[model samples]
Target: MKKHNFYAGPSILSEYTIKNTADAVLNFAGTGLSLLEVSHRGKEFVAVNDEARALVKELLDVPETHEVIFLGGGASLQFYMIPFNLMKKKASYLDTGTWASNAIKEAKFVGEVDVVASSADKNYTYIPKNYTIAPDSEYFHITTNNTIYGTELHKIPEVNIPLVADMSSDIFSFPVDFSKYNAVYAGAQKNLAPAGVTIIIVRKDALGHVDRPLPTMLDYRTHIKKDSMFNTPPVLPIFSALQTLKWYKEQGGIKVLQKKNQEKAAVLYDEIDRNKLFRGTVAVEDRSLMNVCFVMNDEYKELEDKFADFAKAAGMIGIKGHRSVGGFRASLYNAMPIESVKALVQTMQEFEKKH
Candidate 1:
């Protein structure tokens, strides 16, 4: 039986991408050597990197002013790199969750970090609203989706300041106005591909504005000049990411994916609301389409373990919630089959009947 995988990052990928990746692992595109062993600087890998960047621009409708780069060290490196490169003056951040908080910490190390708004008081159950953006601030940073707390900003805020986004969980899951933001970055593991590549799309005008000295690798201009070949890139992951983008394009691109994502979230959220024993964690208006978080009634705490066991026995995996939230979370990314969700809802119904 095919297992229903609901883990958030390094999560499920399309079957076509998986099959192509598997075949390439042994012999890539009729080349004699396995993709895993190919040189990063070779023409084969160069084509892969170039196509991956191009596909991203084409799919997102990124403007001519933007440049896309696939770099190493996940999104964690970007937390520091963004500040180091952009924080010449005061910067503003919206503290939405753990990841956003970490980004604020790194920004403080570089320069003045102003937290314009935060949802920490309510344990990040909703997005904070009605905040002022400083005219003098270098940039305003926001995490588009909160993975741990299961909240998302469906609409990107409009501001005169340069907008920077950490779109790690929801990139390509829906349509985005690429022109509104000065820079956007996402770690590929969640919705794009497996871990190893961090996709950064920055407006060409955003570079060379800061005066701080940067290490060659940390400099955006350095990578831009080299066409993201500043150093040997992650070859296999980039190749796989290209395959995933191709699969996404074949599946009718982001608009179709957005409809599918909304339908998936609606089905799961409807089940959560209809079930008497369960309650959703995030506010209804702010709940995430990617991660659905919920829990049984406090009186039903004794049955938590049994419910989890039952889910596992029925082939549901990674439904366990984060330790901080302590209930259950089902990550419904683009590649997660609708049948898996149907099976999970059926399991929930059966469990409710037993109790």
Candidate 2:
């Protein structure tokens, strides 16, 4: 049976990206040397690196003021790196979910953190609004999408200070105003590439102002100076990212994909709302397009596992929600076919009938 992938991430990738990367593993660019064995600085991989960076700039429409870099650590590293280079005396953050809370913890080590707004009061099922950021704060940080709670800050707040965001699970899934942010970073696993490599886009002027010394490795300038070659980059994921970027552009770019993502989220969410057995966890306005979170209605909560098994038996893979939040999450990333969402909706419908 064909499995419908809803694993969040390291989640589903486009079949094209997967197949191409697999082929490159055997023989990259017809060089007979596997991508795994090639020298990162060699002319072949150099081109790969160059094209990957170029594609990022091109796809994001990143301005000339910003530099895009591929780094080895997942976005977890960026939590500190962001504060390391940007936080001088203080930084502001929005506490929306687990990752955002983690980012807040990391930034506090660097400077004072003002959690301007939070939905943690509600177990993070909603986005906090009408909060104020300190103009005196060094910078403001936000996690654009919360994977755990299934809430999204779909409308980025207008902050006068330098805005930094962790877009780990949602970057490239939609069109964003590149000009508004001083920095944006993401782990490639979700909507970009694979489990390795984190993509960072930093406005050049935002650095060197933090007034403290950053370790050579932790410093953003080091990576920028070396063109992300200050050390061996995650070569496989970078190449695979290039493949995905190429595929994204060929499929009519992010604006096109954003519409599809919205439609896909709508399908599953419609079922969650219409069906008697399940209900969405997040506020309807704040529901995540990438991670649609829901659960069995309170009256039918005991059947959650049975529904999970039923869906799994019907070829749904990885629909389980995060352990902390007991429910279900269907991740609708760029590569997920609408058919998979339809199947999930159908499975939910069938389960409702069975119960």
Candidate 3:
């Protein structure tokens, strides 16, 4: 049976991205050499790097004030790098979930991290509101989407301090006001490409203000100056990202994808709300469009494992929730076709009938 992919990271990829990347892997750019063997310094790979950066800028409408760079480390590295490069006196953070908590942890090692607001009191089920940003804060950090908890910050927080966001799970899912942020970083695994590369779009003038010395590799300036060639980047994932970006543009950019993603989320969420067997995990207002998380209702909780097996048997893969939070999570990334979402809903419905 054909499978519907719902895996979170290293998840679904467009057929266009997959097919083009496969061809390139075998014979890249008609150069008679596989992309795997191509040298980063060579013109062929250099062009790939250049085009990938350009497409990101174009699709995101990234201002000329910012420079986009593809680097090797995941967003996990960026948790430290953000403070290493930006923190002067202290930083402010809004802790919503696991990733945000991790970011706060890393920033503390760099300097003081004032957690202005947090929803950890409620187990991170809702976004904290009406929080104050410290005026002395060097920058404010937030994770736009909580993949594990399935809560998304739909509105960009308005703050005077420079704003930095880790958009690892939800980047490029919709149009963004790029000028609002000093920096936006994400691991490629969720919405862009694979797991090896991380993309950083940093405002050009936001660097060199920090008093502490930054390691050469850790500094954003180092990568910006070298055009992300400070060291050999994650070549394969970068190439795959270029292919995905090309496909994105062909689909009329992120605005179009946002509508499609919304529709997909609505379809599944509606089922979760209407069906008697399951209930959504987070506050309805804060539910994630990219990761739809739900669990069996209290009375039907015993059937959770049976429904999971039923869904899997019906060709729905990766619907299992994260270990920390038990239940089901269907990740509807930019590349996921709506049909797969419907298939998941149907599987849920079929299982509900049996119970």
Candidate 4:
């Protein structure tokens, strides 16, 4: 049997997507050409690109004004590209955690960055509120979910300027009003596909407005005009993303997935609250549905290693917390089955009983 997967990124993918991608690797769509050998510009692969792009728009209900394009670099590149393209003089950023702070770091290279708010004071355990966005700032940036800290922004900030968001870890896992964001970028590893592709959705009108001339490749208009084919795309991962998108539609879209995700997070969170040995780390109101983090109780901290070994021996995988935050992190991505979550809960209970 396969072990339960709880790693943060390059994480779990739907078994259905995996099987189809494997079949494509053997012979894509019965074209007698392996997916690996096929030209990205070929008709068969072009269809793959078209369908994946369409599915993203359909899944997100993105408006006609927004152009969805797949790019080579992960969200890290977008962290810089966003500011490079949009920030002429100044920008605003919300500091949430590791990724968010890195995004802030990138924006600093392009222009003056005004940190609107930050949760660093509390070790990023909670989302900061009551921060003011600078009216003169070119755009406001936010990371919707702090994967490392297990905190999420339940609400989107309303502002007159463009609202750019990095939804790398939470996109498609929950329902979002796509229009509220002038631009959105997400790496496929978390809830979409493998690590090769990053999805970028930007309002068409929002581009070509910055004063600085962006490089041809970094320009959003270039990818949009070429239909994300300025260069060879990560065909296999895009195909895999299409399969995942198909599975998502068959499963009744994001609204339905949101309910299922909530249920899955509830199960583990409830267990974390009930179990005598473990307790959640993030604030109750800001806990992430995608990455549920918990730590051993203060009195039982010595047993953390033992419990980790116990879970590992019981077929659990990738539950180790990050270096900065020492605890267990169970990443419940979109493709993670409810049964797997239950298995983790059961393991936690069984370990608690033994302790």
Candidate 5:
């Protein structure tokens, strides 16, 4: 049976990315050495690092003022790094879900953090609205997409102070106004490459403002100054990312990918709404294009496990939700085709009939 991939992180990757990466693992850049064993300082791997950064800037339309760098720690490390390097005295954050709340928790250790707004009152099913960021705040932070809670900030908030966002799950899913943000960072697992590297787009001018001294590895300036080669980079994932970027450009870039993502999300979301057995978790307006989360209707709740088993038999993989928000989560990332979404919907319908 052919399986449909829906894992939230370390999610599905394009065949183009997978095949090319597999080839490189055996013989990287025409060098006989496996990608896993290649020297980071060698010209072959260095070219991979350079092109990956270049592609990130090109695809995102990142401004000249910003520098793109790939780092070793996952986006979780960024939770502390943002506060360490950017927050001078205080920072403002919007709390929408688990990750956003985690980011807020990390920032508090640095200094004062005013939670401008939060949807935690309702278990993060909706995005908070009508929030105000303090003008005197050092910077405003937001998690643009909540994978676990299945909500997204469809519009970027206009703020006076510098703007920073954790765009881990939705960075390449759509076209963004790169000029508006001082910094944006993402983990490579979701929509880009694999699980080893995190890509950061930081405006050059935003650094060197904080009074506290930063550790060498923790500082963004150190990596930016060295072109992300200050230390040995994640060689394999970086190569895979470059291949993914090339595939993205070949598919007509972000705008084209955005339309495809929207259509895929709509298919599953419509089934969740129309089918008698299931319903969506997040507010309709804030539904995520990357991760479509839903659950069985209240009366049919007992059949959740049965439906999961049936879907498994039907060749579905990784449709189970997070433990904290257990139900069903189909992560429809950039590489997921609409056909797979239709298959999941069919599985849901077949299960409803059986029940």
Candidate 6:
């Protein structure tokens, strides 16, 4: 049976990337040494690190004023690091989903945090539109995409305050106005590479502005000064991320990926809208292209378990939704092929017929 992956994080990667990474794990660049065996400080590894950072800049069109650092710790660490480094007076946050709320919690520990807008009352099923931004706040924070609740901010609102985004789930899935953000961080597991590494792109001018003391590793400047080698980095994930970025560049970067991702989401969403057994969980305008969430109709709710079982039997995996909202979630990242989406739609159609 052919397998299709729809896992959310640590999700599917390009077959080309997987094969090349596997080959490198055995023997990297004909050095007869596995990528795992190489010293991070070696010239070869340094080249890998440098190219990875460069490709990130190219892929995202990050400005010269921005510094891209690939460091350990997931995007979770940045929830605190951003406040510790940037929040001197107060910061504003949009409570879109779990990750955004967590970021707000971390910021409150460092300084005052104002929740400018939130969708919690609606179970984060939609993005809040009408909100006021305080000019005096250090910066406004947002989660670009809500992974658990399958909602996305399609267009970032313009605010006088600098914007900080946690783009862990949707980074590089679409084109972003890099100039509009003061800092952006993402865990590599979703659209970039694998777990064990996080990418931090911060505007250089935003640093050194906070009065709070920071540990050496928590400070972005420390990593920037050492060229992201402040400590031995995650070499394998960085190398794989480099390969993925190279692949992305060859595939025409975010512009091309955005079109493909939209089409992928549309395939499933169209099926959801047309099918009688399923309905979308999020507001149509706020639905995420990365995570397509849906639930069974009231009459078919009793068959939820059966639907999941059938999907599994048909070679579909990870179609289960988040526990916070019960239903089904199909995480279609950049590397997920169009054929996989088609297969999922076919499974949904088949299940609908049976029910």
Pick the lDDT winner.
6
Cα miss at 177, model 1 (Å)? 1.2
lDDT of 4 by residue, 36-102 (tens): 9999999999999999999999998988989999998899999999988777889999999999999
Query: If candidate 2 were superposed on the true structure by all CA atoms, what would the RMSD be?
Result: 0.9
Return the clash pairs for model 4, or none.
Answer: none
Q: Number of clashes in model 2? A: 0
- Give per-residue CA lDDT, model 2, range 317-355, as digits (tens): 998999878889999999999999999999999998888
lDDT of each residue in 83-119, candidate 5, tens digit only: 8888888899999999999999999989999899999
TM-score against native, each model: 0.98, 0.98, 0.99, 0.98, 0.99, 0.99
> Considering summed lDDT, which 10 consecutive residues are worst modelled in model 5?
174-183
Residue range 35-140, candidate 3, lDDT tens digits: 8998899999999999999999999999999999998879999999988888886999999999999999999898999999999998889999888887788788
lDDT for each residue of candidate 1 in 66-126, tens digit (9 for 90 to 100): 9999999999899998888877878999999999999898888899988999999988889
TM-score of decoy 5: 0.99
lDDT of 6 by residue, 1-355 (tens): 9899999899998887898899999998788999999999888889999999999998998989899999888999889998998889899999999999999999999999999999999999999999998767888999989989999999887888889999999999877777888899999999989899999999998999888788898899999999999899999999999989989998988999999999999999999999999999999999999999999999889989999999999999999999998899999999999999999999999998887
Clashing pairs in 5: none
lDDT of 5: 0.92
For candidate 3, what is the TM-score?
A: 0.99
Give the clash count for each candidate: 0, 0, 0, 0, 0, 0
Worst 10 residues of 3 by lDDT: 173-182
Candidate 4 Cα errors over 4 Å, as ranges: none
Q: Of the pair 2 and 6, which is ahead by lDDT?
A: 6
lDDT of each structure?
A: 0.90, 0.91, 0.92, 0.91, 0.92, 0.92
